[model samples]
Target: MNDETAYKVLTGTEFAALEAGRFEGAPVDLADGYIHLSTAAQLTGTVDRHFSGQNGLVVVTVDLAALGEAVRWEISRGGQKFPHLYGRLRMAAVTAHAPLARAADGSVELP
Candidate 1:
């Protein structure tokens, strides 16, 4: 949950793509020209707003330091600074990954 790490929520298919070695991101990311990432605080909202009622989702922990200049913190979603990756995501940059889990209040559980 520290600033050193960011989270990428991916569908099962997208995760499979990443496991293959690299990930270009999802449709929205492709359209936006960057991979969308959320902080621990923003994660639940991102999941609730985008992946509600869906299953088989996974949360990938990204090492922001590894991304270096590829990560840009931009104002987004209620004026908060969100991390966006401007290049392809390689498996080497992923610190950890696990299936998405929700709390009793339906909030996303950080991996």
Candidate 2:
């Protein structure tokens, strides 16, 4: 993935809805109130290839801190506990202006 598409930001409620229906049975991680979602298929494909096959899935992490109070409320409704929204969200690839990089500490660092 390129810089413009490397990161995708979604509201908690939106992610919750997507997770409840579409991403059922996918692996999820919640840490520091943030939700990280990944699917086995996505992890094994292009996204995984871009990430050096690290997780074998396309992972999307939603930061709770980035959500508004109303969004959180909506996401938690109906006794539906929220899980990390992870999956292979497919999109058209675009040409990148510059290359992406990783820091010495192994964190992705963009130019």
Candidate 3:
């Protein structure tokens, strides 16, 4: 199945409920018995220069550390391995925001 068909769109409330332990760590009710979240590197680049013309000039810089962490997360899930749910739980608490994305088919894309 395609990625879109492989996952479900988790509502904000549902996600919050999952975070609040309402689902008991199995928030996503998938037909496969388990759900997986993964990330992939879409693009990476350095801010070589900012445009300056009739409009205005802007400063540009790259956040290497943030990019690095994103790369690491992408790499960690590249193999489609089920991440440690406990770790993800802790990460959610630390970040205070869920890193959720919607696929073309409207399903929630994990990671």
Best-performing candidate as measured by lDDT? 1
List TM-score per model, in order.
0.95, 0.21, 0.29
The runs of at least 3 residues in candidate 2 whose Cα sits more than 4 Å from the true structure, single-residue gaps closed, are 1-21, 29-53, 59-101, 109-111
Q: What value of lDDT does candidate 1 attain over all alpha carbons?
A: 0.91
Q: What pairs collide in candidate 3?
A: none
lDDT of each: 0.91, 0.31, 0.28
Question: Model 3 shows how many backbone clashes?
Answer: 0
Model 1, stretches more than 4 Å misplaced? none
Model 1: per-residue Cα lDDT over 1-74, one tens digit each? 47689999999999999999757889999999999999988999999899998999999999999989999999
- Model 3 has an lDDT value of 0.28
Instruction: State the lDDT of candidate 3 residue by residue for 61-103, as single tens digits.
Output: 1222222222122223235332222222222232223344346
Model 3 TM-score is 0.29
Candidates 2 and 3, the one with greater TM-score: 3
Q: How far does residue 52 in candidate 2 sit from its true spot (Å)?
A: 12
